[model samples]
Target: MNFVSTRGNVSKIGFIDTVLMGLANDGGLLIPEKVPQIPAERLQAMSELSYQELAYEIFSYYVDGEIPDNELKELIEKSYATFRHPEVTPVQKVKDNLYLLELFHGPTFAFKDIALQFLGNLYSYVSKKTGETIHILGATSGDTGASAIEGVRGKEGIRICILHPHGKVSKVQELQMTTIHDPNVLNLAIKGTFDDGQRIIKELFADVEFKNKYHLRAINSINFVRILAQTVYYFYAYFQVAKETNTKTVNFSVPTGNFGDIFAGYLAKKMGLPVGKLIVATNENNILEDFIKDGVYKPGEFKSTYSPSMDIQVASNFERYLYYLLGENSEAVTDLMNQFKSEGKIVVNEEQLLQVKKDFAAHGVLGEECLQTIKKYYSETTYLLDPHTACGVAAYEECNEANDFCITLATAHPAKFNESIERCDINQTYPIEISQLFDKPQYLEVVEADNDEIVRKLEKLFSFSTR
Candidate 1:
């Protein structure tokens, strides 16, 4: 299972290399050379398997040569055991055919836990095998920071630094990252938007000397392991729906910002999972919607909406989709990406535009729509949803109604956004654990958007630690 860079310039790499190098040297995300297929018998038989069992069966192909069979099984089991739910990811039927897939039942109460937890385990295993220490750097809009921190905190032979835009995420989300005062953990409140933070991470990766000096790895969606771990729930949800109903194809409406979650669904379809349309639900920052509907890909101002996690203009994972749309023409895709970065937009050619429309259906919902969905769900079904889940629910209505069985991803627990949830008149309270996080003092550095400044901070931290 070799991984190839989306930019097409870098040499093909083994699974471990792909995992370690989140983005290729050519500035592209790594994708599998081929998306392995799951046999029909296996898909049918999956209905009887447990969540961990299903995960092992589905993900084995991707990590086959990298990790031995027994070790892989152990990793999967241990990774999921930490989750709050035994089922790992459970689905609820809010109405006749509208289902809510609960993915926030992990330590961080966000969908990122599904991937970040497993990724943390995978990182530990690989680091031990190679006898190397790794420094993980990630940029998060909201949930990914807390989830990544939960995954890597207190782990040996690893250091994690997460960057979030200053004043972008909610107070709870900020505390979730900053309250963890482990020496292995570092948090940065970047004086810019999420895009600026992401750009800094990318620049760090591009600097070979800095990356190697710090043993820089990534927990971002750019890492193939994160995507592989995320793909498990799609299959789990599919089988659960199939077992309960006679539905052949299940449509998934994902409230997306970085596009990683829905891209996992795209990987599942390529792997022969009977998934229908992959609906992309966006908040006020609706760059994806515009890209799918028309051929224009543009970046706009980052609006601080109710769903802070989806307040992103540049979807990093979109590069992989462009790789597929261009028939794996990495050169062309790279050129387009460079142009898009320089000009802030790019108009796709007709052929590429046709492919996007074929597989994607996108819709944008405002904060009011999110509130309305939360209110309506509470009134009709008594199902309380966070702002992110409400965004998915609102966008699901704009997509096809013919697909009766639709799974809307509940990305985060309402407690993570208690203020926003309260604004909707939902009257939700935080968990005891979450409520306690507020009292912890936040420890973080505020840095400008200069690469030298970030490097200087890292140097000072490392020098102080060594002394």
Candidate 2:
């Protein structure tokens, strides 16, 4: 299937080209020219397949001409083999009509691993085949940095530089990225919010000469491969829920900041996954919650919260959603995005707002509520939740219908946020695997959040002489 830019400025491109191009040159995201639909029988057939099998089935439609079926299936199997759980992403019953989808089974103990692992393998295959090297630049709030670094570390023909807000992520999150000593991995702690790092990356991509000179690529959700890999778990969770309850409809509550994870669920619904409602759970940075509920897309200042992963004001994946929300009207999507970028706000029309509300319900949880959720769940079921997953649980409890069968995504292992869980005296025991991470020495560079400074640092890291 061919892909096209959401802004209608770029010509039609294939999947591999889209992967390499990342953000479209016209300052827009790329989406498939046509969303493939699965037949009812095929959807039913997926319930009996393994996660790897199901991934191959779903991805076949998108990578038809680019990747062969056998090669893609092998890559998928190898990618998921890194996860500790045989199911890759497992489902646990929290209560009647309420379940917790455990997505931290991979090496990094976060949902981002599910996608980053696949992207790592896919990039290796593509780059090796074409005899090209890719220099990946990415921005993260917390989890994405560690996961992306782990995915591409020590790989030949690829180098990655990840930027994150300094003093914002948890101790473990920071160490997870900084402690990795691979020659190809460079970690930067910028003295600003996640948006600052994201803006710098986007600006670099927009510069034709700079991007071409460095052969830069991306590992952020703006890369369609990340979104495509994430779409698998949504289907996997739904399959398990459907098989157990003998029901077709299931709802998912995703604690999202960049909106990539829930956007994957939205894509699953488009492919006939029987998704009832997508609960867009957020922290104090509630721009996504407000936009989904009211169509008022105003981004305010970023706040530092216990759930640092959700501490974001600008949701990049929202642009891809708006492309579909506006009836695939590329011109309308471009106009609205241009307004948002220029004015810091934009509102959708009534019809578009109605369409958004039909598929999404949103709720924002506070820091106190997040802690309380961990305490409450531990008291009742001896289950400990990280700050981010607690937001999903609180959102599910507050907004879900009484009879709605809901699955809240457990995005990270609680051990990753030992300080937050310990603050409440949760008295939880962590796995030894996580306990050992603190012993590793960290190597990271700290820089002020300035575009020119970042460019100079990157040039120095890559051995490129300044002009």
List, residue by residue over 1-467, the lDDT tens digit for candidate 1: 78898988776588888888887877889999888987888788877889899888877787765788899889888888998888999999898788889999999899999999888988888878877887888999999999999998887777888899998898889989999999888888999999898889898998877788777898889898888888888998988888899889999999999989999999999899999889999999999999999989898777889999999999989998888888888889989988987898989888878889888999999989889889899999889999999989888888957646899999999989887888877677788879999889989999897788888876665543311
**Number of the predicted model whose lDDT against the real structure is largest:** 2
lDDT of 2 at 287: 98
**Least accurate stretch of 10 residues (summed lDDT) in model 2?**
458-467
The whole-model C-alpha lDDT of candidate 1 against the native structure comes to 0.87
lDDT of 2 by residue, 124-179 (tens): 88878988777889999999999998888888778889999999999989988999
lDDT of 2 at 345: 95
* lDDT of every predicted structure (CA atoms): 0.87, 0.89
